[model samples]
Target: MGKKKSKPAPLPQSLALPYTGVESHAHLDLPPFSSDIEEVLKRAKESGVRYICNVFLGHEAWKNNRHLFEQHDEVFFILGTHPSHVDQCTDAELGAMRAAFAEDSRLRGIGEIGLDYYWDHFPRENQKDIFIKQLHLAKELNTRVIIHSRDAAEDTIDVLETEGFVDYPVLWHCFGGDAELAERIVKNGWYLSIPGTVTYPKNEEAREALKVIPLDRMLIETDCPYLTPVPYRGKRNEPAYTVFTAECVAKELGIDTEELWTTCGNNAIRFFGL
Candidate 1:
């Protein structure tokens, strides 16, 4: 496909600059964050962030949020069988995800679910099976997948294509891979979401990969309250802080910050159906 020109759409003054409508991709269920969540969410919305794609790390995390999805217009959740949690679960448990998804239209997609061979917590076969099952769930639900792939690009891509996502939306959240693989994902029409990782000056590979990702297919995230970008690098990350990631991406793309912010905001909205 040809590269599309990065023409920015005009945004309202209130929604302008620094940025609004940022997306945070990660485990939002951690206990430390639960206490100040109302204040945290208020700040996020005030910052112009439209929504969060909170991924539950396991089935246990999934049970607490039946009302959380409905609590905020800007907070959305993804129900999936995480690769890390596969060892603790069974096929029956994974199957229940489909049932839960079927009952709740609020579920925008399936994922933070994919292969992660970097850790040996789950068996290779079990991870593969759960990944494929979740992909199948996405197909059945006619929604996209917020994928998580670490050191398993080939295996992840292989399963995605084989399971049949020729036209489905797949997002590689917190993407930290090479340019070649970045090109491959873009070529296949999958979207890539970057987090604060891009802000680190030492992360040249992520910077290079940013060059290959089309602005239309790129999304910004905090992946927090971890992977906080500079300034907040050592602090807890939240949705409001995702603007730093957009700033980093804008710098790399050689474009104005506001322009890049608008582009990423639109991409996140379109990708997550927010």
Candidate 2:
């Protein structure tokens, strides 16, 4: 064989930074890294990630897998029923989540809750009902809310505004809209969690949109095992991959990587009250 091309190095291997970056959202409890959870967590820590926020999909997942991160205090939690999974949002489940929040100090917020009009099978009415329930619960607990809206931004904002959530501790998780949408969210005093999708080549809308997101109101997240960033787009994502997102976002904003990374981490810290 002629000259062989060398494989690309992992993002973290080349990304140099202090151990202060926080992964605003992740799903390590998922099955992708079940065999090497320790390695994954260790890799994330070694990659300059200070903490990782694990979002539990529902009460059952939280009840079953919260222990996996018990020894790893750096992994905080946001538990809620996803809009698609409203079937599980029973009164018993709500009571269980409320009890869990009270019993576990690590449960920091209510999240991954809101409208997902992208999926037509799930009725909008049902999604709205459960989302309102969780919003009310978050208000009752006096905790932060992490919203997950997809293709339903108007109604989502309307519902939140009607519920008196403007200026509240709310985060629009996995934000991928245009600059106008970003500006609107900021106007409402809500934070936006930018995901790895911003690194995609064809996502010019998102890349350009990111320019308008205020530094203090922005947070970076892997949303792992889902929107893996560039150079690793075809592979499973993890908290360790947050560096690539930080890199992309920092470049897009024409700011220093370390500065953006630390600022986003601080934003998440303040949002979650960690």
Candidate 3:
């Protein structure tokens, strides 16, 4: 008999949940999706992503692509200099960022800005300086703050505490902290955003942290063009895959996916004032 043909696996279902939640953090302005942003957003919409916050890692990126948000009212922006690109930001840029925040209503928050010791490209002191400046900017504007801390949890916590911005609506984006840190973050009335990493089998730490966070304090994100969830790990991530992260978080917390979806959606809406 002739050899039988094997069928390819189907593309994972897009809208895996009933509710279209917000993609609280993403880099839609990055190069990966520069060619097909419309298609990428269309997929996100089909996958139940009602809103998206396109976080800029540096002032230049924000300047070049700020108009992208104008095409869709559902899309918003958070401006800041990421730790890795802290040196790229200048005094004039900082002033411009503040001015932009004041002028634009769609400028929802300040961040994807925090400590990242994982990469040694920029000096630690410089990163901290820029981070503190933006934190103050967030406070001055009375807007939400989205943080990015990797391998620098202690310093991140210290800066947040010392800076006295814990009272602000802060979201620890792409959180990889342990249960202990999760407790501290929630105790301070801050939020923890679960990324696609939660779906990975080896990410017990993220799942463990998720257990300690109350539903009201939990938000789901893809951190897309990166951190693609399991089953789609090797491929480039997009906002559409946020559902898979939400599903994994729901399973971890022992709740219905719909309930999880609604709670996280509400949490994003409240935190970002969307």
* TM-score to native of every candidate shown: 0.88, 0.97, 0.93
Judged by lDDT, which candidate is best? 2
Task: Please report the candidate that would top TM-score against the real structure.
Answer: 2
Q: Model 1 — which ten-residue stretch has the worst lDDT?
A: 7-16
Candidate 1 local lDDT, 1-274, one digit each (tens): 9999865422222334653455748566787587887778777776667777787765567777555556776777787766877765566776777677777666788878898899857888889987887777678778888888888999999988888875578888888888999998998899998888887989999999989888888888887888888756787888777766776788888998778877888887887777
Model 3, span 1-274: residue lDDT tens: 9999976423435446654588888999989998999998887777777889889776677778888767799998888888888877788888988888878888888887899999867889989998998888888888888888989988998999999976668999998778999999998889988899888999898788888888899888888899999768889999888888887888888888878887898889888887
Tell me how candidate 1 scores on lDDT: 0.77
Candidate 1 wrong stretches, greater than 4 Å: 1-20
Global lDDT scores for all candidate models = 0.77, 0.92, 0.85
Order of models, best TM-score first: 2, 3, 1
Clashing pairs in 2: none
For candidate 1, list the clashing residue pairs, or say none: 20-48, 21-48, 21-49, 21-50
